[model samples]
Target: MNKISFMLNGEKVSLYVEPNDLLLDVLRDKLGDKSPKYGCGRGDCGTCTVLLNGKSVRSCLILAIEVDGQEIMTLEGLSKNGLTDLQKYFIKHSSFQCGFCAPGMIVTLDEFLKKNPKPDEEEVKEAISGNLCRCTGYVPIIRAVMDYVKNRGG
Candidate 1:
């Protein structure tokens, strides 16, 4: 096993990981980070999304060893301080139903908002297109993000 060290949720963390072990597995199994759920193991599903060096990526598709010296941010990290504005907006808009996609959608949007603080409705829809939520039909999710952006002066 190769030892890998990376910044997780603004904290430095190191652990032994096999070259073939997926980042999602290491985070959930070894590190006990349960936010990045194992939905579709393939990259098609965004349920395993996480931020890698401030960018959204599918943790399931990345090898743990590849994150050595990198930075990862999961929903657990994003909410470490408490409910972020986006999260509050989500709650206000009732964005989620089953909530399985909440973490990935939130994480993905967190990065997107940082990149494009002022995004149109279509842009917000496109940003969360990868995350599939069978319930809520995505209308509420879009509204929540748009509202958050507007409230943030974007």
Candidate 2:
């Protein structure tokens, strides 16, 4: 096992990981982070999305050892102080159906909005393009995000 050190959920963490262990496995199996689920396990599905250094990434595509000294932000970190206004909007609009993709959707938008708070509808759709939701359609999700952008901040 390889010893790796990184920040998780706003806290510093160090743990052992196999050489080929995926970040999703390390996060879920070892660190007890459940937001990044095991979807396609090939990075095609955004259900395992996480924020690495403020950028959204597929945790399943990352090696645990590669995160040494890096900062990893999951939904746990995002909700440390309770849900944000955008999260409320998501619930208000019922952006999730099975909720499998909700974590990634929220993580993606959290990062995207930080960069482009005033994104247009098309831009909003494009922002979450990588995250696919098999349950709820995109219209409600887009509306929720757009509402958050227009009223919350952007």
Candidate 3:
């Protein structure tokens, strides 16, 4: 096992991992952070998405050791201080149905909104294009994001 250290949800963390271990497995299994779920083992499903250095990335496609010194943020980190306004908006709009994809959707859009504070409906759709939500039809999610942006003075 190779030793690695990195920041997770603003906390410093260190662990031993096999070189081939995927980041999603390390986070959910080793680190005990279950927000990054396993939808598809392949990178096609964004359910394993996480923020690496403030950018959205497919955790399943990344090796655990690749993030040794980088910063990683999961849904847990995003809402460490309680529900954020974006989460509230999601609730207000009932953005999710089965909720399997909620974590990835939220994490991806959280970073999207930070970079593009003001986004149109098309932009919101594009931002989440990589995330596949079989339920909710993407309409409620778009509405939630747009409403959140408006409420935040975006």
Candidate 4:
């Protein structure tokens, strides 16, 4: 086991993890942060998406040791009091169904909007292209993002 230190959900954390353990496994199994789901083990699925230093990445493809000293943000980190504006927007727009892909989608969208606050339809689709959602058919999801951008004056 190797000791790794990182910031998780705005808190400093240190844990012992195996060299081969994926970051997603360490976060969910060891740290008890279960928002990042286990989807395709490969990087193709963004169900395990998390933010590392303000950028979104697939946690399943990253080893726990590789994240040492980094600032990691999971879905749990997005909300302070209650649902974040984006999350509220998602709910207001009925952007999700089944919700398996909601966590990854929300994280990815949050990062994307941070970068491109006023993203157009095409850009919004491109931003979440890496994540796959079998439910909601992408319409309400995209609409939710657009609505949030409009209301935020982005």
Kindly list the per-residue Cα lDDT of model 3 for residues 1-154, writing each as its tens digit: 9999999999999999999999999999988999999988888879999999999999999999999999999999999999988989999999998999999999999899889999999999999999999988999999999988888899
List residue ranges in candidate 3 displaced over 4 A.
Answer: none
Candidate 3 lowest-lDDT run of ten:
36-45
Q: What TM-scores do the predictions have?
A: 0.98, 0.97, 0.98, 0.98
Q: Count clashing residue pairs per candidate.
A: 0, 1, 0, 0
Model 1: weakest 10-residue lDDT segment is: 143-152
Model 1 residue 4 distance off true place after TM-score fit, in angstroms: 0.7
Model 4 lowest lDDT segment of ten: 74-83
- Residue 89, model 1: lDDT of 95
Q: After superposition, how far is residue 37 of candidate 2 from its true place, in Å?
A: 0.8
What is the RMSD of candidate 1? 0.7
Per-candidate Cα lDDT values, in order, are 0.94, 0.91, 0.94, 0.93
- Model 2, 37-137: lDDT tens digits are 99998888799999999999999999999999999999999999999788899999988888899899999999999999899999898999999898888
CA deviation > 4 Å runs, candidate 4 = none
